[model samples]
Target chain A: MRDSRGAEFDDFVRTRSAVLLRVAFLLTGDRHAAEDLLQEVLEQLYVRWRRVQSSPEAYARRALVNRSINRWRWRARRPEQSLGDHDGVARDHADTVAVRELVVGALRALPARQRAAVVLRYLEDLPVVDVAAAMGCSEGAVKSHASRGLARLRGALAESSLVMPITGTGSSR
Target chain B: MTMNDSDVRGILHRATDDLVSPPGLLAEVRRGGRRRVVRRRAVLAAVCAAVVAVPVAGVLDLPGNAGDAPIASPLLDEPTRGDLATDDGYLRQVRAVWQRQIAQSDDPPRGEPNIVWAGDTPAGPAAYVAHATVHGMTVGFVKPTVDGPRVSTLTQVTDTETDGLEQAALLGPQRDVLLVLDFGQPVEFSPQLRYAPGGKVERTFEPVVFRDGAAVLSVPPQRTKLTVALSRTPVERENMIHIDGTSEIYFPDHKDRPGPPLVRYTLPGAEQVWGIDPVAEDVIAPTKALAEYLDPVGAHTHNGSPLLWVYGATPDGRRLLMETVQYDDDPSHVIALLAGPQLPFEAVASTTADWSAPLPVRLRLPDDQGVVVVAEGSALSYRVGDGQWTDAGRNAALLPATATEVRVTDANGTTTTVPVGS
Candidate 1:
């Protein structure tokens, strides 16, 4: 039984931690902070491993998202810093890099909940119900956030002339 | 770029590609797990060796749907463990929750909020309170107990989002009549209710086979009324019921109770796990007289057991005290001192004076780094080289602890030596 439980927990961490880390990074804008968020969530999952393993990923995602939102409150509010045009970070795929930057920039600009909804729905490919579950909101609320987040992303990308570059077929520059 | 779902998915995928896990985290997790497992096994072995086996019967507290019940399988794989007995159980719990809400509502006696309850027939209930305007008279009620599975009677109400699904039991001759109310929809109700009078048997039957499954039943279009329904579960499963004729039903006059604006911290070692701005006009606007009637309530935990809770607000409106009741034991010590004369809004930097303040402890740091005093009302300041306490500005945010035999000079240069984390 102990072995099985350990195996189950390992499987959970392997499969879901990447997605959770990405969302955490988007919300926190720091890789170290994202890792900390994942650690906190994994610790929580460890404590409730037996009860949550069946839906371990879902439970972890919700905990991570909520923790991010809650963390935004108490800390000293920092002025959002834009990653200047992916500068040295952009690699071979210029369009992909640009799109990635656009997404990161757009996400950084959004209020926390909408960004969470977009990440859950479009990025993670979670169902509307699951997204709502992660967001602690109704399905309608999830839809509204998705709509608003998409609009904001579009507007942000349009301002940057990078929308067509990324979404238009990923043509190598 | 205006992106659709597919486009957005692509961007998110690429943006997250490089964020793979750092090496050694998994190893650390395994090491921790092994330690815990060994400890647990050792404890179990000790218990087994210490005593002769004594059997303790485990309590079987399964609800009505223990086996092969319709609502037994949760929609998602995760089971919702709570007071979900059946639809009836849901209705009872919803009623209890609402009754408490109504009694404790800070609203005046004249302002009765509309109560919305949704659930399954033999399940638990979920209720919502909304201050909205509704058109048409819709009365919702539950039938009394008749022992028997076949005492399954059904009544139908207007199929709308607000009204949700309707449920009822028929008794005596009333069991034969299917009374349906049509606010206007495709479905029609046949006047028959299923009941065996007095027996402890209520078996399930197709609700549509009875006339209660109506799209639109006829009633004089009543205007502006409060609506209530008693069912056994969440309304997510009851999307099939629609009140077609009631397209004009408006959910106007909505006034949700405002809450504090929350701020989350990403920096390391920040003691404030979560903070909320209570001074937002939408949150604590027009401070309630009851806000002054605030008192410390006992600490408790929420479902997921996070350390969060409400304790009491002040009367004069200068300060509001909140305790992270769910996070730890003895929440009284963890009270949040807000800025109002009672409870003020959350600001970037706040100084709390009331309740209790952290005792000013004098500290002396090593020579490389000066002593940085951190406390409320006063600013944190520290300087590197040989300098007077006046060298570092009062509002200096961070102070380096570098040199050996450093001095922890308070905002006032009056220095004292104390062990760190003592």
Candidate 2:
């Protein structure tokens, strides 16, 4: 029975790791950091597979977001590391690459909490309540983070001549 | 021109469109999971053994039937003013307390026990020690007194919630210790030190907004007055003046460039002040070699015309200056001139491509002396004292010496001169 459960967990990991990686990458701006975050969440999920198996995807997503945000906070309190010039733009097309760099740079510039809110709300398309749950904050707090984050991103993009307007009440889509 | 909600959403989706998990990720995760499971089981077994032994030992020591002598209580002993002056001494005292606790326990501390002494607290000395347990990592704080060290309540720090403790030294002669427990979650942290009288000071970074190439931080319900001082000339106290709740701090892209500020504040009713580096990104000198080269020269520069100007130092004690004329069609033409103690203002190199404002340039001196200039938006070019110009790609170049002034040629074929000095 334990071997069968392990096989089942392996199957879940093989299928969901790719989707989770994208979420982790967006949460953390670096690919290597993203993988580390995903691996950590997966390890925890494996330990509590019996309880989390009912909705493993949601559990994994929550753990990923929470851990990534926590890591960001830890880093902020500590001494800052050198900022590299590379923006991980490895696309063949120049225009697409420029836009990607701009978006990623702007996203990274947001404060840790705000960035997490923005990624969960827009990128992952999670509702405000879900985002709040994932971030360990109230729904109202999540809305505030997403609103402020969107405003900052719009302002940053405007500086680069890529103007974006923040609209909507930041509710569930 | 205006991007709507969908546009912003689309941009985010496109940014992460290409990201995919790498191979062998699952296998690695499985191995780590197995290790964690094994550690958990070991800790559980130890706990169960301790539970059974505690009752058995109690029964064995029933009133008069003394098979075992009464365990000497370390706490009952008179407190000694041990030498807790140095940090190492304080750490030793903390470790001794942990060893005593483990010896008394039915099951010894599993895994490698590690202890870190933060510093001397008002209570005496404080340290954070951790040992492995069946559940996870068991973390405990050692609060020392004149008598000896006492272990505070132990908290389990699991792999998931691994945000640890921070030892912040408060201002005063006593140098009271402030232990900050950061649980890597998004909850607000209002850590209060026993020695501090003021209501807890909550530190939070208001959302970051960039204005005029500077990051503006806003903290609401203003608690303490903040002063942003440049790290290079901290004594100058040329603070970035701001309103009560909002302050604008600049993080310069180039390390040599002035104004990566540090924020200092004192909590209300607290006599001592604390300082922290506010910028999230590290500020390193753009080029170590170029910065070293410029150190001796002490060069400085300002543009006479709005078009172009350059001034900086060389590795040796020589100053440099360069000026350029503004060209309408070809903004990239940077007229590099060598003007110092020995060299005249001779045009050394120029770029044919269009360049942007704030033209970056580095001077190579003593050896293959030349100026490596990066016209913004153009390729980096290197030229040795009026020699053949070589394309050195688009990255910033390190030159042997610093330039005192940089000159540029304008579209009207008019040359503008600028003064650069150190």
* Residue B191 in model 2: lDDT: 22
**In terms of lDDT, which candidate is strongest?**
2
Give the candidate number with the greatest DockQ: 2
lDDT (10s digit) by residue, model 2, range A106-153: 889998789889888887788998888888899999999999998988
Error of 2 at B27 (Å): 1.6
lDDT of 1 by residue, A113-158 (tens): 8888888888778899999999899999999998898788767755
Residues B1-422, model 2: lDDT tens digits? 55556777877766665443433345446545755675477567756776787776743322212313222212112122223324566667677787777555433355445653244444455555666544334456566555677765444333432322211112222223333322212222122111111111122222222222122122122222112111111111111111111110111231111111111111121111102221111111121111111111111111112333344333333333333322112122333433345443444444332333444333233344444443332344344444555444332333434344444333344433222222
Candidate 1 similarity to native, TM-score: 0.31
TM-score per model over all chains:
0.31, 0.35
Cα lDDT of model 1 by residue, B272-310, tens digit: 322443221112212122122111111111111122222
